[model samples]
Structures are given as C-alpha cells and as structure tokens.
Target: MARSAKAVPWFLFAAGGTVIAFILPVMIFITGIAPAIGLFGDALSYETMHAFVGNWLIKLILLGIIVLAAWHAAHRLRVCAHDFGIRADGAVSIVVYGLAAIASAATVVALLMI
Candidate 1:
C-alpha cells in the first residue's frame, strides 16, 4: 500500500492541539492578564519583550507555537466546514491548508528578521 500523505498534517494537527491546549492559556495570562494587572511590574514592557525576542531560543519557541497554532486552527476550520455540509472538501482543504502554510512561512520570516 502506498504511504498515506495524510500522516504529516494529522501529526501537526495533534501536536498543535496539544501545544495550544497546554501553552496558550499561560501565554495569554503572561502577555495579557498579568501585565494588565501589574503582576510583572514592567517586566513585560515593550523593551523587555523586544529583548526577549532577541534570543534565538525564544524565537524558535515562538515560531513553533505560532505555526502549530495556525495549522491546528486551519485543520479545525476545514473539519468544521465539512461538518457544516460545505461538501467541497478539495477546495476547502486547499484554502485552509494554504492559509496555514502561508501563516507558517510568515511566522518563520518574521522570527528570523527579529
């Protein structure tokens, strides 16, 4: 039997879901809620964030999170479209995955430029 091309995207979707489930809420708290509530006390300020992103490791982590999240969202959207009786799986797959690919590329480029 021919190897399934579906494996990679499925893997990414699962991994992305795990990443989003585990990390996203903490990120929201750190970047959104904690800062607003003065929990970090200037530790999360603009200059601090700029310096944080200046690190290669941090950049890689951010790239992974953003790209995976994009792919996860894309796959979920595609599945939802099917469930809603969109019926055009081919076109839906192309559009959703294309957007995910574009998002992944953009994330890499943006991180590298940082």
Candidate 2:
C-alpha cells in the first residue's frame, strides 16, 4: 500500500486552477475594469482597499489565492515541459516548484507588511 505523494501538488494545481478560472476574472474586473469605468467609485479607493486587505480573513484568502495560483502555474509548466519531450522531470520539478515556493513566500511577506 504505497501512498502517492504526487497527489498533494496535483490537488493544489486543481484547486488553484478552479479559483483562477472562476474568481480571478471577476476580481480583475472589479479591481481593474470597474474602477476604470467608474463603476466602483470609492469601493476601490486606496484607503478602503487597504482596509479590506488589512483584515485577517481577507489576508488569508489573498494568501491562498496567490500561493495556490503560483503552484498551479508551476505544475502546469512542468507538465508542458514534459509533454514537449523534456526528460529531466526531477530537475524541472525542483526548479518550477522552487520558484513557486519563492513566490508564495514573497506573497506572505508582502501581505504581512501591508
């Protein structure tokens, strides 16, 4: 009965992909487009937005989104490389996952500092 450790990254990738596909666009529109089109007014103002992000719950959600998305992209890249005839999966995994780890760490630090 061997356990497959690969399930962990695959899980993150799937969850991240789902979030990015479903939520990211709405987020982008709210944050980017709505403001530009004057739809949100002060909802996206600096003070209000800062306050929203400063909440612990919001911080956690943002952290999850950022980290999971990074992991998702990394795993996708690794798969694409494999599909393209790249054979060094171990090295590719280390590189891409390492970058994701770095990005996740940076996201945490940035969120904490905000």
Candidate 3:
C-alpha cells in the first residue's frame, strides 16, 4: 500500500474536533461562566490565571487547544466551501490550511512569549 499524506491533516482535524467538543466548553465555563458565578472565588482572576499559565505544562495544553482548534476550523471551512459549490478545492485548501498554519505558529510564539 502507498503512503497517504492526507493522514496528518485528517489526524489534526479529528484531534482538534475532539478537543473542541470536549475541552472548549469547560474552558468557556472556567474562564467565562464560573468567574461570573463566583464559583472559584478569585481562582480565575488575572493574577491567578497569569500564574497558572506561567507553568510550562499549562502552556503546552493551551498551545495544543489553540493549534488544534485552528486546524479543525480550517478543515471545516474548507469542507463548507466545497459544500457551497466552490469547485476550487486546491485554492480553498491552500488558503484555509495556510491560515491554520499561521495561526498555529502565532499561538506557539504567543505561548513562548509567556
């Protein structure tokens, strides 16, 4: 059997979808809802969050979430474009995946800067 280069993007797409479905909501709750409800009592405050993100492991997790989410979004958009009668799969894939790559690189730089 011949090797298929499509596996990498597909893997990223699946992993990203999983992360979005599973982790994104909890993140929204922790960063948005929980604080509003005062559940953690300043646990999610700026200082606390800054300190939390300062950890290398936390940074890695954050990076994964961001990169995966970006890739997932890009792949979704590409498919949506095709579904919408856009026959230019090559161009669409290039634009969408390029944006994902840029987003991933930016995320890495941003996380590293932290």
Candidate 4:
C-alpha cells in the first residue's frame, strides 16, 4: 500500500520515540537491578558505582534515547511552531531537522568516546 507523505516521518518518529520511552526504561532498570539489589563483602564502592554506570551498555542506551528523543522533540516542536504560524514552512523545517541532526551526531560521538 502507498503511504501518504505526511504519515511517513510521523510514523518513524513516533515509533522510535515510543520504543525509547517504553523499552529503554525497562532495560535500564534491569541493567541496574543486580547492583542495586545484591549486597556483599565486596560491595561496589562509589567509584565502582560510577564506573558501572559509565560502562558501554549503559552509555549506548543513553545515547539511543538522546538520538531518538531529540529528533522526536525537534519534530514535535516544529509542528507546534507551524501550528502557531511562528515561522515560514521552509525555515521551520530547516530549523527543526537541523537541530535534530546535530543532536544525533553529538550523542553518537559522545557515546563513542565513552
């Protein structure tokens, strides 16, 4: 079936944003549970706690949300801007997509460095 032009981006943005909101929180909670629940003679210290949080898996999850949510936020904000007639269509699209792209890039780079 042929999809309408308007439905495409909104579908992607909403799907991505929903997965981020739903699955990612559960993943984060699961990831942290062992540390939070288990206690021992060799219990993790404050520094170790920081390092655990700084691990690659957690970093990746955080980066994913940042990438998805930033775009979602930008798109929503653009729609609101258009609804309010605060800017021309061309300018609004540019501003929204541009910020989303920059946010995505920054998030990926930050994750890579961790």
Candidate 5:
C-alpha cells in the first residue's frame, strides 16, 4: 500500500502568518497610516497607545497574529533546513517547534501581562 500525502493548513497558516506579520508592520510604517487608522489619532500618547492596545479587540488581534506567526516560523525553519539538505527530520522538526512554542508562549504571556 502507498501512503498518500495531504496538504496541511498549518503550513500555510505559518507561512502566511510570518509574511503577513512582517509585511503588515512595514506597510503600516511606510504608509504612516496605522497611527491614524489605529485607535489614536492626531495626538498619540503613551497612555493612548497602552489603552488602545489594552482593549479586548487589540488583544484578540495580537493573539491571532502571534499565534499564527509562531506556527509560521516553526514551519519555515523546517523548510529552510530541508532546503539546506539537512536529513534529520525529527531533530529539525523538534528544534523548529521548540522555537515556535517559546515564541508563542512569550507572546501570549506578554499580552496577558500588558
């Protein structure tokens, strides 16, 4: 019997997440529109920034982004190692996932702390 391979959403979720995360931030900075589009406008203060990000909506957004980003990093690292001709799939996956786990944990913790 032959084994069949199926596409995984996690792979896309991770790759897409990483690309989107970096691109979104850069685009925001370049366009200088995030500030105006964000919760604060005209005069953005530390308090305003904190308050805005502290909202549930912001929390949800951050969580969504970070969760996906972490997953994306894990998958990308695997692909990178594979591309580099690394044959240790188990070790590679473990290391990649470890990074993702740590990053995801930190992101969630940081959000809750704030």
Candidate 6:
C-alpha cells in the first residue's frame, strides 16, 4: 500500500486544531480579558512569566504550539482558497506550507536565542 503525503498535513492540522482549541481561550483571558478587566495577577508578572518561559520544556512546548498553529492555519487557508473557486492547489499548498515551515524555523531560532 502507498501512503499519501496529505496524511502529514492532515495530522498537523488536527493536532494544531486541538491545541488551539485548548489554549486560545486561556490566552485571550490572560492577555486580553484579564489585563483589561484588572484580573491580571501576580502569577503572570514579568519575573514569573520570564522564569516560566526560561525553562527548556516551556520553550519546547511554546515552539510546538506556534509551529502546529501555523501549520493548521496554513491548511485551513488552503481549503478556504479552494472553496473560493481558486483552482491553484499546488501553488497555494506550496506557499502556505512554506510559510508554516519558515515560521517553524523562525520559532526554533527565537526559542534558542531566548
């Protein structure tokens, strides 16, 4: 049996969607709602947040989140473009996935730098 390359992107899309679903709301609450409504707490303070992000595991998790999110977004955009009567699947796939790859690489570099 032959394996289709689509399985890779589909897997990424599914995983990314799952992660985003769980994390996006929490992020919005912390970064947006909490700060705006004065619910921001000491746990999210500069030093605390810095230390949290300073952990290697935290960096890896963040990198995974960012990369998966980008890949998921790319897949969604590709599907949306197809639905919009754009028949350029090859080009769209290349551009979208390429952007995701670039984003992933940049994330790795940034995380390492930090």
Q: Backbone clashes per model, in order?
A: 0, 0, 0, 0, 1, 0
Model 2 weakest lDDT span, ten residues long = 37-46
C-alpha lDDT values of all predictions: 0.92, 0.94, 0.93, 0.74, 0.72, 0.90
Clashing pairs in 1: none
TM-score of each: 0.93, 0.92, 0.91, 0.62, 0.70, 0.87
Q: Which one is best on TM-score?
A: 1
Compared with the true structure, the alpha-carbon lDDT of candidate 2 equals: 0.94
Clashes of 2: 0
Candidate 4: tens digits of C-alpha lDDT, residues 1-114: 775576755865896689777876776665566457764423466676567758889887777777777777877887899889786867887888798899889888866775
At residue 51, candidate 4 shows an lDDT of 75
Candidate 6 lDDT, 1-114, residue by residue in tens: 787789999999999999889996787788678867767567677788778888999999898889999999999999999999999999999999999999999999988887
TM-score of 4: 0.62
The better candidate by lDDT, 2 or 4, is 2
Question: Which of the two, 1 or 5, has more lDDT?
Answer: 1
Native-referenced Cα lDDT, model 6:
0.90
Candidate 3: pairs in clash: none
Off by over 4 Å in 4: 1-4, 19-46
- Among all windows of 10 consecutive residues in model 5, the one with the lowest summed lDDT is 3-12
Stretches of candidate 3 above 4 Å error? 1-4
7-96 per-residue lDDT for model 5 (tens digits): 463655656676676766874673376565674454466676678779988898877766676677677778789899999978987887
Better of 1 and 2 by TM-score: 1
Report per-prediction Cα RMSD to one decimal: 1.4, 1.6, 1.8, 5.4, 4.7, 1.9
Candidate 5: residue 60 Cα off by (Å): 1.0
Better of 2 and 4 by TM-score: 2
